[model samples]
Target: MPASRDQADRTQRVQLPDETGPVPVSIVHAEPRWFGVPPPLLLFGLAASLFVLALVLLAVGSWPSGLILLGLSALLTAAFLETARRRPGSERMRAAHSWTSSRLELAREHAKRLAEVQGLRGRRAVIESERRS
Candidate 1:
Protein backbone atom coordinates (compact mmCIF):
# COMPACT_ATOMS: atom_id res chain seq x y z
CA MET A 1 0.00 0.00 0.00
CA PRO A 2 1.16 3.62 -0.72
CA ALA A 3 1.47 6.20 2.06
CA SER A 4 -1.23 8.91 2.04
CA ARG A 5 -0.34 12.58 1.27
CA ASP A 6 -1.02 13.69 4.90
CA GLN A 7 1.25 10.93 6.25
CA ALA A 8 3.96 12.12 3.86
CA ASP A 9 3.66 15.71 5.29
CA ARG A 10 4.62 14.56 8.83
CA THR A 11 2.25 17.05 10.47
CA GLN A 12 -1.14 16.69 12.18
CA ARG A 13 -4.24 18.94 12.02
CA VAL A 14 -6.97 19.55 14.62
CA GLN A 15 -10.17 21.60 14.69
CA LEU A 16 -11.68 23.81 17.40
CA PRO A 17 -15.43 24.37 17.18
CA ASP A 18 -15.70 28.03 18.29
CA GLU A 19 -12.72 29.62 16.53
CA THR A 20 -13.79 32.35 14.08
CA GLY A 21 -10.54 33.64 12.52
CA PRO A 22 -6.78 33.66 13.05
CA VAL A 23 -5.81 34.96 16.53
CA PRO A 24 -2.05 35.49 15.99
CA VAL A 25 -1.33 36.00 19.68
CA SER A 26 -0.49 34.42 23.00
CA ILE A 27 -3.15 34.42 25.74
CA VAL A 28 -2.49 33.51 29.37
CA HIS A 29 -5.28 33.17 31.89
CA ALA A 30 -5.09 32.77 35.64
CA GLU A 31 -5.85 29.47 37.32
CA PRO A 32 -9.60 29.14 37.82
CA ARG A 33 -9.63 28.03 41.43
CA TRP A 34 -8.41 31.14 43.23
CA PHE A 35 -10.56 34.30 43.05
CA GLY A 36 -9.49 36.33 46.07
CA VAL A 37 -8.15 39.85 45.66
CA PRO A 38 -4.40 40.17 46.21
CA PRO A 39 -3.19 42.02 49.29
CA PRO A 40 -0.73 44.13 47.27
CA LEU A 41 -3.60 45.81 45.46
CA LEU A 42 -5.04 46.90 48.77
CA LEU A 43 -1.67 48.30 49.84
CA PHE A 44 -1.35 50.16 46.54
CA GLY A 45 -4.82 51.67 46.92
CA LEU A 46 -3.94 52.95 50.38
CA ALA A 47 -0.73 54.53 49.11
CA ALA A 48 -2.55 56.15 46.20
CA SER A 49 -5.17 57.55 48.57
CA LEU A 50 -2.43 59.03 50.73
CA PHE A 51 -0.78 60.57 47.67
CA VAL A 52 -4.05 62.30 46.76
CA LEU A 53 -4.36 63.60 50.32
CA ALA A 54 -0.84 65.02 50.06
CA LEU A 55 -1.76 66.69 46.78
CA VAL A 56 -4.72 68.35 48.51
CA LEU A 57 -2.43 69.64 51.26
CA LEU A 58 0.03 70.93 48.66
CA ALA A 59 -2.80 72.95 47.12
CA VAL A 60 -3.69 74.61 50.45
CA GLY A 61 -0.15 75.18 51.89
CA SER A 62 -1.45 75.83 55.42
CA TRP A 63 -0.06 74.59 58.79
CA PRO A 64 -3.20 72.56 59.50
CA SER A 65 -2.90 71.03 56.02
CA GLY A 66 0.62 69.89 56.81
CA LEU A 67 -0.56 68.39 60.09
CA ILE A 68 -3.43 66.56 58.38
CA LEU A 69 -1.09 65.09 55.74
CA LEU A 70 1.37 63.98 58.38
CA GLY A 71 -1.37 62.30 60.42
CA LEU A 72 -2.76 60.44 57.43
CA SER A 73 0.66 59.45 56.09
CA ALA A 74 1.54 58.01 59.50
CA LEU A 75 -1.72 56.09 59.58
CA LEU A 76 -1.14 54.56 56.13
CA THR A 77 2.37 53.49 57.04
CA ALA A 78 1.03 51.98 60.27
CA ALA A 79 -1.61 50.02 58.39
CA PHE A 80 1.07 48.51 56.13
CA LEU A 81 3.12 47.73 59.20
CA GLU A 82 0.17 45.94 60.79
CA THR A 83 -0.19 43.69 57.75
CA ALA A 84 3.56 42.98 57.89
CA ARG A 85 3.08 41.47 61.35
CA ARG A 86 1.88 38.29 59.61
CA ARG A 87 5.35 37.97 58.00
CA PRO A 88 4.21 35.62 55.25
CA GLY A 89 4.83 36.79 51.63
CA SER A 90 7.38 39.41 52.62
CA GLU A 91 9.63 36.72 54.08
CA ARG A 92 9.45 34.67 50.88
CA MET A 93 10.37 37.74 48.74
CA ARG A 94 13.28 38.53 51.03
CA ALA A 95 14.51 34.96 50.83
CA ALA A 96 14.29 34.50 47.05
CA HIS A 97 14.30 38.12 45.72
CA SER A 98 12.49 36.96 42.55
CA TRP A 99 9.20 38.67 41.73
CA THR A 100 7.60 37.19 38.58
CA SER A 101 6.07 33.72 38.81
CA SER A 102 2.76 32.43 37.34
CA ARG A 103 2.37 35.20 34.77
CA LEU A 104 5.39 34.06 32.74
CA GLU A 105 4.56 30.39 33.18
CA LEU A 106 1.04 30.91 31.88
CA ALA A 107 2.36 32.83 28.86
CA ARG A 108 4.66 29.96 27.86
CA GLU A 109 1.97 27.33 28.34
CA HIS A 110 -0.55 29.31 26.26
CA ALA A 111 1.94 29.72 23.40
CA LYS A 112 2.58 25.98 23.39
CA ARG A 113 -1.09 24.97 23.58
CA LEU A 114 -2.23 27.58 21.03
CA ALA A 115 0.01 25.95 18.47
CA GLU A 116 -1.15 22.48 19.49
CA VAL A 117 -4.93 23.18 19.62
CA GLN A 118 -6.78 21.93 16.52
CA GLY A 119 -7.22 24.49 13.67
CA LEU A 120 -5.25 27.14 15.61
CA ARG A 121 -2.09 27.33 13.49
CA GLY A 122 -1.41 31.00 14.34
CA ARG A 123 2.14 30.68 15.70
CA ARG A 124 3.76 32.66 12.86
CA ALA A 125 1.34 35.56 13.34
CA VAL A 126 2.10 35.64 17.03
CA ILE A 127 5.85 35.59 16.47
CA GLU A 128 5.60 38.39 13.90
CA SER A 129 3.56 40.65 16.20
CA GLU A 130 6.03 40.06 19.02
CA ARG A 131 8.92 41.01 16.72
CA ARG A 132 7.20 44.26 15.66
CA SER A 133 6.73 45.28 19.29
Candidate 2:
Protein backbone atom coordinates (compact mmCIF):
# COMPACT_ATOMS: atom_id res chain seq x y z
CA MET A 1 0.00 0.00 0.00
CA PRO A 2 1.05 3.61 -0.44
CA ALA A 3 0.97 4.19 3.33
CA SER A 4 3.26 1.24 4.02
CA ARG A 5 5.64 2.32 1.23
CA ASP A 6 5.73 5.85 2.63
CA GLN A 7 6.51 4.57 6.12
CA ALA A 8 9.26 2.31 4.78
CA ASP A 9 10.78 5.19 2.84
CA ARG A 10 10.76 7.47 5.85
CA THR A 11 12.50 5.11 8.24
CA GLN A 12 14.61 2.03 7.84
CA ARG A 13 13.40 -0.84 9.97
CA VAL A 14 15.31 -3.80 11.34
CA GLN A 15 13.97 -7.02 12.79
CA LEU A 16 15.49 -7.95 16.17
CA PRO A 17 15.30 -11.44 17.63
CA ASP A 18 14.15 -10.19 21.06
CA GLU A 19 11.58 -7.79 19.69
CA THR A 20 8.02 -8.53 18.66
CA GLY A 21 8.25 -6.40 15.53
CA PRO A 22 10.61 -4.39 13.39
CA VAL A 23 12.36 -1.49 15.13
CA PRO A 24 13.35 1.69 13.35
CA VAL A 25 16.79 2.98 14.12
CA SER A 26 18.29 6.19 12.86
CA ILE A 27 21.81 5.89 11.47
CA VAL A 28 24.32 8.53 12.37
CA HIS A 29 27.89 9.06 11.12
CA ALA A 30 30.31 11.19 13.11
CA GLU A 31 33.66 12.32 11.70
CA PRO A 32 36.44 13.16 14.14
CA ARG A 33 38.83 15.98 13.21
CA TRP A 34 41.98 17.12 15.01
CA PHE A 35 41.64 20.79 14.02
CA GLY A 36 44.61 20.80 11.61
CA VAL A 37 47.04 19.37 14.17
CA PRO A 38 48.60 15.95 13.94
CA PRO A 39 47.76 13.52 16.74
CA PRO A 40 50.22 13.63 19.67
CA LEU A 41 51.07 9.95 19.37
CA LEU A 42 52.01 10.35 15.71
CA LEU A 43 54.29 13.25 16.51
CA PHE A 44 55.87 11.25 19.33
CA GLY A 45 56.44 8.31 17.01
CA LEU A 46 58.11 10.58 14.45
CA ALA A 47 60.27 12.04 17.19
CA ALA A 48 61.33 8.58 18.32
CA SER A 49 62.13 7.56 14.75
CA LEU A 50 64.20 10.68 14.28
CA PHE A 51 66.07 10.00 17.48
CA VAL A 52 66.88 6.46 16.35
CA LEU A 53 68.01 7.74 12.96
CA ALA A 54 70.21 10.30 14.68
CA LEU A 55 71.79 7.60 16.81
CA VAL A 56 72.50 5.52 13.70
CA LEU A 57 74.05 8.52 11.95
CA LEU A 58 76.19 9.24 14.96
CA ALA A 59 77.36 5.62 15.04
CA VAL A 60 78.26 5.99 11.35
CA GLY A 61 80.40 9.13 12.12
CA SER A 62 77.98 11.64 10.58
CA TRP A 63 78.31 14.06 13.46
CA PRO A 64 76.71 17.14 11.86
CA SER A 65 73.59 15.34 10.53
CA GLY A 66 73.26 13.41 13.71
CA LEU A 67 73.35 16.55 15.84
CA ILE A 68 70.76 18.24 13.63
CA LEU A 69 68.43 15.26 13.78
CA LEU A 70 68.89 15.05 17.51
CA GLY A 71 67.89 18.66 17.93
CA LEU A 72 64.89 18.19 15.64
CA SER A 73 63.84 15.12 17.58
CA ALA A 74 63.99 17.01 20.85
CA LEU A 75 61.91 19.83 19.38
CA LEU A 76 59.34 17.40 18.02
CA THR A 77 59.15 15.64 21.35
CA ALA A 78 58.43 18.95 23.09
CA ALA A 79 55.73 19.73 20.56
CA PHE A 80 54.17 16.33 21.05
CA LEU A 81 54.10 16.78 24.83
CA GLU A 82 52.54 20.21 24.50
CA THR A 83 49.94 18.97 22.05
CA ALA A 84 49.05 16.02 24.21
CA ARG A 85 48.60 18.31 27.21
CA ARG A 86 46.34 20.69 25.30
CA ARG A 87 44.40 18.13 23.30
CA PRO A 88 40.61 18.69 23.36
CA GLY A 89 39.59 15.32 24.73
CA SER A 90 42.37 15.00 27.33
CA GLU A 91 40.23 16.30 30.21
CA ARG A 92 37.35 14.10 29.13
CA MET A 93 39.68 11.10 29.00
CA ARG A 94 40.98 11.85 32.49
CA ALA A 95 37.47 12.28 33.84
CA ALA A 96 36.38 9.04 32.26
CA HIS A 97 39.37 7.25 33.75
CA SER A 98 38.63 8.56 37.22
CA TRP A 99 34.99 7.70 36.88
CA THR A 100 35.86 4.17 35.81
CA SER A 101 38.20 3.76 38.78
CA SER A 102 35.57 4.96 41.21
CA ARG A 103 33.00 2.64 39.71
CA LEU A 104 35.43 -0.26 40.04
CA GLU A 105 36.00 0.60 43.68
CA LEU A 106 32.27 0.75 44.32
CA ALA A 107 31.77 -2.57 42.58
CA ARG A 108 34.53 -4.10 44.67
CA GLU A 109 32.93 -2.84 47.87
CA HIS A 110 29.55 -4.18 46.78
CA ALA A 111 31.11 -7.56 46.00
CA LYS A 112 32.75 -7.66 49.42
CA ARG A 113 29.47 -6.87 51.14
CA LEU A 114 27.66 -9.49 49.09
CA ALA A 115 30.31 -12.09 49.96
CA GLU A 116 30.04 -11.29 53.66
CA VAL A 117 26.27 -11.53 53.53
CA GLN A 118 26.50 -14.89 51.74
CA GLY A 119 28.95 -16.18 54.32
CA LEU A 120 26.71 -15.10 57.20
CA ARG A 121 23.72 -16.75 55.54
CA GLY A 122 25.70 -19.96 55.09
CA ARG A 123 26.77 -19.94 58.75
CA ARG A 124 23.19 -19.33 59.93
CA ALA A 125 21.96 -22.23 57.80
CA VAL A 126 24.61 -24.56 59.26
CA ILE A 127 23.79 -23.48 62.83
CA GLU A 128 20.05 -23.96 62.23
CA SER A 129 20.62 -27.43 60.75
CA GLU A 130 22.75 -28.42 63.75
CA ARG A 131 20.07 -27.16 66.16
CA ARG A 132 17.40 -29.13 64.30
CA SER A 133 19.51 -32.31 64.49
Tens-place lDDT digits, model 2, residues 1-133: 3465455568757975786578888999775666977877677678889999999999999999999999999888667666655653566544544554466589789999999999999999999999999
Per-residue lDDT for 3-101 in model 1, tens only?
667857577688768877896788997633324433543553565577577777777776577667757765654454444333335655333222222
Residue pairs in clash, model 1: 14-118, 14-119
Which residue pairs does candidate 2 place in steric collision? none
Cα deviation of 31, candidate 2, in Å: 13
lDDT of 1 at 40: 40
Residue 76 Cα positional deviation in candidate 2, in Å, after optimal superposition: 0.6
CA-lDDT, candidates in order = 0.57, 0.77
